[model samples]
Target: MRTLLQAVLSAMLLALCITATTQANERYIVKFKEGKESAVKAALDAQGAKLALDLPKHNAAAFSLPAQALTGLSHNPNVEYVEQDAKRYLMSQTVPYGIPLVQADQVSDSVTANIKVCIIDSGYDLAHEDLSGNRVEGANDSGTGNWFTDENHHGTHVAGTIAALSNDVGVVGINPHGNLNLYIVKVFNADGWGYSSGLIAALDVCEAAGAKVINMSLGGSIKSRTEDAAFAAAETAGILSIAAAGNDGNSRYSYPASYRSVVSVAAVDENKQHADFSQYNSQVELSGPGVGVLSSVPMGTALVAATSVANHDYLAIAMEGAPTGIASGVLIDCGSGEQQCDAAGKVCLLQRGNISFADKVLACEQGGGVAAIIYNNTAGQLNGTLGTTVTAIPAVGVTADDGAAMLLDVGNDATVAIGPGNYAYFDGTSMATPHVAGVAALVWSHFPLCTNKQIRAALQQTAEDLDTAGRDNYTGFGLVQAKAAADYLALNGCTAGGGNNTCKGKHCR
Candidate 1:
């Protein structure tokens, strides 16, 4: 039986398709009044609350207090508000097109060991080869077991997009530099579910660990006051929060992301258009490549691959297995009325046009074709699925350029090989969120002196404005541009090109 995630992927695959934390430790954000530092500590110690973070900048501290002592801690005269730390889970990446689209490739040389970016989601896979040397030890789990391990693959994927190593194999991250160190904060469990308190605890841990940026790919419809206070406090402590603008394809807002304190990111495809499912509203601050993004998955999993073209290698997604390998053969165009073209024992190539993906593959199968390769007639790579049609021939998708090149070499042989180290395509505002986070890391790493507010301004002011010019709901300030933001920061110090100060609101977070 297919799980809900699998079922959702199936429906989206047909459309080109598709696409936390720990528990425990009664977490609370104890905000203290001015000059109440010693009193705050005494209250925390008296309540037996283990201090997780000491935020001197915000005059507050986060602690894991016993649930029974919550009332007493709240009654403290110096304590401003003691709220239960909320839980946030891993939102689930693709070389992801957003990387290059946002010009992250241009700033590869700006590596920094001092810039710590926290992925506050499902913990990470510490053993991931691509993430080696880029991770910081001593992950914060908020009392959840399994510490920094990513059982859900979502956190690992998000981590890969932000700072996958500059290795030869696997997907490269937005910031391929070796300097940016990733700190994992596991708030969600193996099931990808978490609470508000857990998230608050993770934020405390992030600030304590000296994380300059926090990337949250997960979100919920309901907003928690405790969660808002934590985020607001993190902002006050000079930590930039980036989040996904929901994936419901509606105007309804999601917490943390929709909060004014965090930078909300929307999803876009390779075509630089709004994704069908990406949520939109005034809260959306920016956009990134989120559709059919190809990136790293966990190790030992079945990795997808293909080898048929000469000059260029295409990221092929296997929709249906062909059982046996299809050796080189004359490519026959079996599109539209030409379904009868002698595809017997040959690799049938079809262009995405009038017929449905299933119909095209069925045509190839009917013609005795050993395999089928469908290339997109339009821009971007083909990501169509054949539903559940059990065709004897294997089917795969290729980019429009690769298909055109293959057409030019109609007589050349193509090969389809299935092996390990699988790369996948996923879609969501969750995927877009990391792109912005990564770009922010790149800029912040380049200019360590820039405050979190300045970093946010650089990103928003220098973004590639789309939709209705200035800042729109769908594309926000347009797609995030790493080099552009970096250049802006270097030249203007968070000031817009028009010489206007972009970092205005101190309480916007």
Candidate 2:
């Protein structure tokens, strides 16, 4: 991930709060008075303040103080907390962009049955509907082995995306047959924000647990000796640590993601374009669908939103209407509890779990509906998620919040349009990062013998170039392709894109 001149400076200052002990670059955070928001901002601006944001209720200005003025600003009565701001980044979300599991199996010859990927996010509800027996040995909040629970559902979503059961159950994860080892650190609070020390403790657990892949979806705006050593150790341990590129559309990359050692995963939408919130540049190694991603939630919960489930296989003409002119739509989520939805017109809102998005859409069409809108019932506002094998109707999505708002707005004359169209739809890079993580696990599982570097390379190298044609700020190595990655991984004596044997362009093709 990339960083801006302003963010870098500010993060250094804020890093102090978290005990960031890195000499890479000094950062500081300067707090100001509650009512003097404007004055503090203006003062920082005149001094060429790089980046600054109003602290929620603190009336403090957590800004990146210039090196020379740190002493003076820290002493100012208007200032409150002058410390390093850790660079917080979201965890990478991943999923299969193209090609199903059966197809993927055909490309590689190996057993992913034993690889135990360690998801280090919130934690899983092990008892989730889509994921259960698929979970292997692990640690969790229970303080005992083989027992884990996700108070926040984030870890559950990440876990399901990585390795939900392959059985003909609710949803098949990217690596349905893969073994997963969950390591719970609970760095993020129930609200999803924790102290730097908590993060370090989590990393300690991940490292000690002997996990193959550690997924970190939580991070702060600051970096500490705590995080630096943890990530560097992971790299040395030869374990793959996938991280999220921050959600701030700005180039303000977070730690671990920007730490140079971690594999920074960016969010690519269904359109195969980099999400507006996904960070970019050299550090962003690969890409995957991150908006409205579908995966298991807490409890036996199966959520429809994590990343916008955009992948859909159009079924043959089987609708009773014989369909004409209008693009009849069927969705897995109507953004509400009731089957009927009015986001735009008559549509069915498919309930999460037990049923399929396609089956629900087809049934809705049979029941006489013009369109469908599927949605996640999570905290944030998402529009839709990937749904395959649905027929006779176009489908879109909405987050639980927006969906509820629209459903509650019924009878009112107010127009409703939910979306990933803006900031509200954004809930951090976690929303978009799952796709990248899922895809990585899928491609890696395919080529069991391929070095982790090679798998990571195939993902980035064989991807279809989009957004800017060649590599650019938005989409890193283009959209992640399972077939391309699997095929590349099958090659012998392969290396990631770097040295002489690197794969790229038609040569990679």
Candidate 3:
């Protein structure tokens, strides 16, 4: 998938820029902020330099004329960077706790039914039982076949976090039944980070592919003009883009995510504690869990030690001693939604939601068991169906009824062992991003007429205020309030008021 982003981006970069120029041609990039947009445009027009992408938020303009064309505009004052458009932002909040949803409304409103979303990162495992049905066809853009196969598990985890199907089988997505068209645009290599140019191409392909929303979970520190052009094109085309603030706990920002037009998000734990690793910036637009989040993993791989599920397992660990791997012990993996927990080895117990073969082994390993067993956590007769592979270690899955009986008969009651079910308790900023994405999909989906800007603003406006009275950096606009988005769209998006014409809430504002 990352390769595909590279291939397509290279083609786009070569696709002839608007005004056409070589470095020696001396075209000048002009930028402004707050109240200085029109003056620069008017003055630049008077100088005969063709107007390019008019980015209102940054007060920046792309000009294809020589520096001489900017004789007046340059000295007119208040302009920022006067170089090429730089793609210099990305996303990666630090908190690990997933927000605890006290009630399971599971977003009944189908705000995003037909809209397409492009996730440009690691590949997605669409074949997983929980995600298989909701998998968007033609979602893979990784020119490299390996892109569809999330080897690092980051892409699949990120993908599962964003649009895992909302069906009652496995994990519940924010927009449970939002009809979202998903695309996997891989911009990273197997290792997970990629050059800016690769991601730049992805923006073009994503825009061309008709994706209304784009989720960029990966990022870097350096800036690039190539990236800026891509972002401008997408915004000009009306695509709403969301990016993660870097994991570095500093006010300094990363590219693409830090870009004025992109939505910069931070991370908060389930306790609503700000992540130490999440960047603190006046520019951060909103926030969600970046800490230990429980999300889907690759089909055949074991989740790295940093997983939130692992953290949850660590929390209730009744380790007799720090014994190595459990060769013969009963282990249960807890989950409430329809998630795919694939564990191998012994006594693997499943949680709520859907069951995949991996769920059993995943639970067993986490729970330190040698063999494997899985059970349905749902209330009905959970026939205990999940995805699994035949292994040297014996493995079997059972219904919630059977597992509870077995646990009671064979195990002691000293530990805080969460019983059989598909839902596993996990946390992370990754988990929170999808909630926002799904809700965005729902709003954008229902109100097809709403511009990408309107959708973004609606999300910000409706976000349940978690911290401050209005908007604060910790919670940003607050918890992603879905109904607020829906109601606002129905009320505001329905009848077009001229426009909100509000400034990007930042230091100056």
Candidate 4:
């Protein structure tokens, strides 16, 4: 009886050990010796490893296997090396700096005057706090979902740039007073793409809704004659149409924007420099702030990180994939964060470079850091992302100047807070499109009696010419200026250019 009981206990123990070992699987990339790919794969298969990816060109294969099996695999003559399969992330969006750059802030609140601007892109987030207060309406042509709920954040971001509420918490749009009657026509689905037929149908919806300006921050390489006819008709109907000039950074023409009837908007940086990725062509009509443009995304999908030391708040941007929480501790400098330091129970202040943001944050967390702050090695802001690497501590980025100042105040109590917020930074001519559209609405509201052609002419004439001086392919007539365009119209009546004086009400007072 004693022998039988001992045998049972031994079997139970062995089963538990094997189960634990099998559950401890981790993903890794295993490189094989030249001409030994098949042998290495077979050996890995014998070790109970599951193959994930096969890269014959690089002589590598990704697998998920027991951590204990790594040693034996590395010893195989066919195996070259084994390393962890690291994660990668998309480029993160940043804050909006285009409002004042495009002179939208200089326009008066009365300039809004209930002008209707239609957005045709991904669906809008009707529930967004910054957008919920506005008189917004929409219709869904894409087979995705409802027009009010945005599964993809592109439309919501674009809408915020044109009309986010002037609420103090989140971002404020060009028409910040919530005065414009926004008509959203969701042509693009959650995949960030749509058919040309869907877009033309959306134009019909815009016209029916009585929208005076249509913002099309989307395009394709192929130009459809039917789509061109639709835009031309929309233009003839006195509706101002604005579109992105593509982000290809080439001279190739992008549809809709390339059409004669549409205002093609190119992207420029904060300093009014043409973006390298912004397409340059004779069709480009105007330029606006597009690079690092901060605007509203879906609520809770993004956040703004705030950092402060000794009651001094410094401008900061949250690292992508950072946790939403607050971490406060004594600040400790961890130069480059390449090597571990005495960061235990403190906020680790690391300088950017020499390693990935994830590695730096990992080193801090490994050393028991309560939070992490990475300063730029260069002059501009350090916008870093952690990919899929998650940490227990909060991580934020600051400008080089702020980072330098913080380095001097080491050992001070600092706080890094990232919580629920709705704003994000996005780059592309898609971002520039909204700026021009919003400016058009703002200027048109003041000159309601002016024809669409007249308003278009005023904007082109008043633009701050950039790049190759007067009307070049890069920046066209240059940056769209809200106050300048408004001033030009005020000085010259609607008939100053050519169109008949359609004045009936108070004319450009």
Compare the candidates by lDDT and give the number of the best one: 4
Q: How many backbone clashes does candidate 3 have?
A: 85
The alpha-carbon RMSD values of the candidates against the true structure, listed in the order shown, are 24.8, 25.2, 29.6, 19.1
Stretches of candidate 2 exceeding 4 Å from the true structure: 1-110, 141-147, 178-185, 300-428, 445-450, 495-509
Q: Provide backbone clash counts, one per model.
A: 24, 70, 85, 4
lDDT of residue 491 for candidate 1: 60
Give the TM-score comparing model 1 with the true structure, all chains together. 0.67
Error of 4 at 19 (Å): 36
Give the better candidate number (2 or 3) by lDDT. 3
Candidate 1 lDDT over residue span 334-384, tens digit each: 755246557876778888888777788788878877677888887766666
Question: Candidate 4: what lDDT?
Answer: 0.81
Worst 10 residues of 2 by lDDT: 415-424
lDDT of each: 0.71, 0.51, 0.53, 0.81
* Ranked candidates (lDDT, high to low): 4, 1, 3, 2
- Clash count, candidate 4: 4
Stretches of candidate 1 exceeding 4 Å from the true structure: 1-97, 108-111, 138-148, 188-191, 300-302, 307-315, 320-344, 350-368, 386-393, 400-414, 494-509
